[model samples]
Target chain A: MRLVRQLFTVTGLILLSAGYAHADDIKLVNQAFKEVAVVNAKGEKEFKLVEPGTVVPKDEILYITTFANTGDQPATDIVITNPLPNNSRYKAGSAFGAGTEISYSVDGGKSYGTPETLKVSGSAGQTRAAGPDDYTHIRWVYTGELAPGAESTVTFRTIIK
Target chain B: MAGRGYKQILSRLAAVLLLGYMDSSFALGTAANTVINNTAVVDYQVAGVPNAVNASVAFTIEELLDVNVVSLDAANVSVVSPSSGRQLTFLLTNTGNGSEQFLLSVDTALAGDNFDPVPASARIWIDANGDNTLDTLNDILYNGTNGPVLDGSTPGNDAVAVFVLADIPAGRTAGELANVSLIATSVIADAAGEVNNVGAEITAGGDGGVDANIGVSGAQSSAIGTFEVVNSGVSIAKSVLVFDTQGGQDPHPGAVLRYTLQVTVSGASSIDNLVITDSVPANTTYVANSIVLDGVSQTDAGDAPGVDFSDFNISNANTVTVDLSQGGNITVVPPASFTIGFEVTID
Candidate 1:
């Protein structure tokens, strides 16, 4: 009876710690897609996003990141950061997220600012306003709190170099 | 683990192929089979506690198939009637992003030409020595089976020298033209129809089992080389310089007329016993000791062993003869020129 009591106590302690670790429960999923031109049922030509099977130079790719608050409490101060992949250049004005402030980083994610405020040093050591090609990372700050079990998505595009 | 090993082998193959050429700056973009990995992270606060989560995705670049062909010959190759072994040079390049083999062919019956090269005598060869000249002994002939293998993974190693040779028909005349085309087709299966179909994938069809896609060149290219028949002979341009008694440019009596003969040999063959003879003008007197061959004065005496090969009034009276071949002891090759000058007095 003494051994059984000791086992029950250990199991209860493990459950308590598992619950404590679940407090910060946010899940993230990232995906990539390529656009293809196809004719719909009405015979109108339109572009549709699909899985990229064969990519070549200059092909555009769309990246989407979805985050969900799986905890019981609302998640606040939500921030998402993404570093652009190699052999690719960011497309201008492609980042999209509702109710969020989007910014960019040109100094290898050390600092972030809006497109007009961001600066990058040219090869000649002259500082200038950063362009889409100079972007090395992208960040999004959600303005509002995320309710429990609420999911939202942010997207951007890049072209293979 | 197997995939990583395969990728390593593919990279080694690419390096080996890169050694074929010395300089390469023409590659388009990211190399084939390069992996592009992306990851995104989310940081948020749950009940005032900071936490983070991340996700990742990755894919590999595909190979692109393309090729380019150009005529290396600046102009039409000069040939002679009933000639054999005339060559026209060309350059074949693989512009795609993979190592590829090509099937070569020649078409001698092109339209808009003066004549056609003998179809049976037409042949193709690879410039094995890279000298741009067709060396039959060192170059490999295209027997409709073997073709050039070019490496497109790098820039400098992608091009190869090609040559097309043909025989001139016996009845062809001078100034006639014959056009020949060299065609190079990629040996990859179904490559012809899939050309320019961007994003179309061929599974395990590229170098080292990588997938390949069609590029802009459509995987096939051809260029034309022409053969022009030219007469193999000699031509002369004669200009006269007159020294009148008053040093004026008039052919008057007692005035000396110095005639300059610019002789040029054309075509490919050499001539033996190249003897040049000229008669004195009707009313001009022969100027003794005035015969000159190529800026050197010649003795006005019969041909001797060491004296000279020029003499006046030897073959006929009032005639000057200059034996350029030195009594058949030398051969005068074409595309060669000589200047012979002599002065005569007006009667």
Candidate 2:
């Protein structure tokens, strides 16, 4: 019977502890939560290459592209690729802008490898490596995420094949 | 003992019932509390014309330069209208690990000039559980008005609120970006939080740093293109001569000879604010009259166009006028057309 009384007392204590706020008491309280700002938009992007109707030796042919992040939310999954046109050839070592990868194909864009496959090589042997001279196509992808209302630029050079 | 036991049981049961009622009532009241946890009001900025290295190039914002996102503070962003008394349930989140209580505000001072800004007046909403309905809490406003413009002279203050939060998501994202968006009045330029980048940036203090002159504001970005110039020799073609003096045509010494002034921009870079001068050819003789360029009347303005020179003019006509071509105003209106009639005397 004593043990039973002790058990009841414990239960009563637990109930008193577990129960929050008592009757006949008015609780006036206020709390605030913050939200972090998110801007996940990359604006409208544009790219164009105007052809100059001339074939001069060593005269660098330029291709230009404009990029803008329009959405408030930043953008990811950046992929930049371009095939060297038939009448043109890529010059080695020219790539710029957000993030990018350059590839060359001796088979006319049918397949691409590092410069080494085309008889040119980089620090990593057997890799189709390219320099300012053996460029065919240009491509790049951004590794990092672009923030809201952000913009970047890209440019490359080539010669008439 | 039996009677005492029955009374004790009855008293205990009554106490239990009273406690149950109180618990139920307390729970119901606590659940009635409405506070928004998700909010999306945000801000950003673009570097000003002062930041641009190039000067000769006319400054225009084509894009919004963005910063790596850390989080969004939408405590002030609400969907409820102040007058409607609708509830606005806000959700505050951290897109990135960098959590802070950034100030959120609506300033109309920029609207007076920028043509757009956030809405005029808005209120906070409450989400009462079980009710599932939004209840209004506070109406947000910058200054006393619902405009982004403060005065014609000063920079506008942004409508702002401070929100405190613990975490946005489960993990700690160092580079997570956040946003706070709200419904905007048409009178305000921004219906959302800097939706179009048009020179938007984020700083410690919300200043929406942009200055405009003559309607055109600098964009966060701009573009440049280059073209080679191969100037061809001056164009010499047979000249067509006409004599008209208010419907009076006489080329024989008394006739006014009308000539055209033409100019063009052809060099690669675009040029405005130009001034060009062309002397009358030695073979042409004239007294006095008028001149113009491509529909635009010029007393003596820019003579340069992109790529090439398009400047040419005929002055010295007695009553007739000469204007420039694609180059600019060379057309003669009706009243002037009647005056454009004149016969020239061949030398």
Candidate 3:
């Protein structure tokens, strides 16, 4: 019975790897949170990354995600999608990433477009311009291929409501 | 072997269900100032294989609300005519733990005072520049046509200028008083009512939430404005002095007597047609130029220019009269006083 259990565990891991064959090669590293603060007298905001279990409200937070290609070959058409956390609204024009085209989703990732092109249904069934509160997801599409051992980071800001 | 497999499957199912529950429960939006858990999923394609990974973070919302309104400068104001834009000034402060918004309204028909026959329109103003003066440059009017949304303390301690404005109606008689009330309510209150009590936490269970202060002990604060119309006319005091060849040790038959009349005008409004008259005592002669209005000597000349009166007449050397209205141009107003001194002989 013990041998069979071990065999089953190994088989399970092997099948998991098979299903997500390329997932191990492209690793999604640690996720972090940064708060916007005005540390100087100039009324300018400085973003400082916070550890887990930090308190925030009515404040701007930058969510940063790091990913890397650990394989031997280059990775193509790398697209990463992240939903705006609950109780938070996206900060307009705050998405930052090199060589990436940013788009937003208003319908829980069902659709995507720039801020101006996005529309949301109002209470009276009328479609209006999508506000920060209507944002559901943020997507970053890397324009160029990422070579092996290459790491990239994407960040976007959201204000806790 | 079958039993073991069944146990493993059951354990896996439980784990999956528990994870699903946590994702559905904690991933949703919670109330303000409470712990909210959020998770983000990253989906990407690596070498033609689609993959996904997720991470979560928890944060507490900052929640604090305090507010207060300072006492007004004038609780009771006296006005003769019912006019528009009668203003009472006050200071609105946020004394709570967080920033908030306040909704202001006026109740002209509050109990305990005479209600205006027609309800007066009430409005508010902010001393934008903190000069405490309502002017074109510093005053911002908040009216019902376009309601005002006032901010309370948040980024810093906030003291706001608030004006209670009203209009008194015409024909408001003397001793008749009217009351006007200004009430400030928290905009975050669940309903449009007073929020005197501390709100409960959202995680504590039921649906009620905390609210901002409105300058009162409780959720709603109200200040009363009392307007009283009064009729204050004038008051006069009289004194006598006697002189003689012997220095007037007593009131002798040949002693000269001097009488002084002091007149005082009172009340908030101005008055017209102030007339003073005196009957000369028996055997006493009227002294010329003995009458004085605020230290200015007067003559017994009626309608004389620059004489301080339109008419000053002494009839039959026994009656003395002084008219203050100089042909409808001059009259004694409030905060004014005068003394009239004249000499007479005892018969």
Candidate 4:
């Protein structure tokens, strides 16, 4: 019985050799990098509050925007536009770029109105009253796109009624 | 014996070797074996290295294009003086990996050849035209004489740079190294359209070696020193030394002309305690007195002076002056100034 089993095993070896007859000499390897850890820097101008002399009330505030793209791709045509809210006065030349529209509000941020310099088409009537205690968030709209690895920003001042 | 995949792999290897031999396409990069266990061999001979430090220029194109630069700039050059007053010299050379043009100058402030600060000039001439090799112009007359004060254009040539020292005032340090300048400006034509005027600083060194800036085949140079003494006693400081009394002057009663001689090394090397012997002529007489050095007086010969260096000095019978001198640090030097005096009464 043992001789028969050995004979069958030898036959099986022969069959296996006849079946699949190839293999690859495997090898492990290491790779290297060309460059890494890039860094950069930038400069900004000091933000000047329009009312330099007088003491501003608790409701009034002023600050500027500093934006960073941190992403691999850059954003263009970034825009930030803000209108003077109630009780707030828009400082001249405070905007970074030339905006197509310029208007003002005496009542809080609700009603649409033009500056006193622009004439009211009809008689002034029941429009919401704008005052210094109103919230003033400015809007900045842009038309161009920021490129990869680039950044930009905008800013303005406001006083809450 | 070949393994299981031996035939297939052998066929592939044959194809690779054949492809490598017949094709430039398989010459570089991972194109042939892109997937070799994630590793691809990157090998190339190191170029741009021939002109680096410690490299020499040869007669071949490779060596010429890779000529190295050796700067003997005064930055590391210095002159050492034996004593504060001993004369000293600094040597700076370009001993050349190729034709070198340069300047060797000094600001003799303290411890230069002279105790004074002397920086005369940096005017040197080179073979501007590479004429023959040395940039020697026929017009260059060294020291107002013929030839260059220090001129060598041949790759391994050398030149001795001489700087005159100034008078060391009392209580002052050795003047610095300056007023001496050795500059070699090469008029080379670069890749640009015009000729570029470039130069190198050459320093002074005492010996011959690489740092000496002399060259591969090094040669040494030397500086000479001298000093003197004068007795306000006469037109020419009396040679109080009495070798003869014929022309000697008589001071008062039966007195003979006497003098003093001081020898010091103001520059370069120093002399050993040298005994200068002079025979008292038949007409000369000797006076007993002591010689002073470093403010201390010692008898040249005591009637019964115990220890004998008696050979060092002999008086009366035959006058001998042993100027036993030593330099500061190295040997015979200066600044540790030395003066020897003697008194003689004649018959």
Q: Best by TM-score, which number?
A: 1
TM-score of every candidate: 0.69, 0.19, 0.40, 0.26
Please list the residue runs of candidate 2 whose C-alpha ends up more than 4 Å from where it truly belongs after superposition: A1-58, A105-113, A116-135, B1-347
Residue A1 local lDDT, model 2: 39
Model 2 C-alpha RMSD vs. true structure (Å) is 33.2
Error of 1 at A34 (Å): 2.1
* Pairs with steric clashes in candidate 1: B24-B156
Best-matching candidate per DockQ: 1
Candidate 3 residue-wise lDDT, A1-161, digit = tens: 35644554455456556663333456664454544233667775443345523333444565666667776657777777888877677766667666789999999999999999999988888999998678888989888887888877776766655
lDDT comparing candidate 3 with the true structure: 0.61
- Where is model 1 more than 4 Å wrong at Cα? A1-24, A40-43, A72-77, A91-135, A141-152, B1-26, B128-139, B171-175, B190-201, B230-233, B239-253, B258-342
In angstroms, the error of model 2 at B318 is 99
Ordered from best to worst TM-score, the candidate numbers read 1, 3, 4, 2
DockQ of each: 0.28, 0.01, 0.13, 0.01
Q: What digit string (tens of lDDT, one per residue) describes model 1 on residues A92-114? A: 77787767899999999999999
Instruction: Tell me the tens digit of each residue's lDDT in model 1 across B90-159.
Output: 9999877667888898999899999988889888999877788788899999987688887776666678
lDDT per residue (tens digit) for residues B1-347 in model 3? 12443244334433433343221111222343465555655555554544555556566554434345654666466655656666667777644334445667767776676656245466677776667776646677775433334333233235666777777777777778877666665555425343665533223111123322222245456666677765557777989988876975477877778888898775566778777778788776666667666667777776556655612344334566767666567766676877877767777
* Sort by DockQ, top down from the best: 1, 3, 4, 2
List candidate 4 stretches off by more than 4 Å.
A1-161, B1-181, B184-258, B264-269, B281-284, B302-317, B325-331, B334-337
Evaluated on CA atoms against the true complex, candidate 3 attains a DockQ of: 0.13
- Taking chain A by itself, what TM-score does each prediction score? 0.84, 0.48, 0.77, 0.36
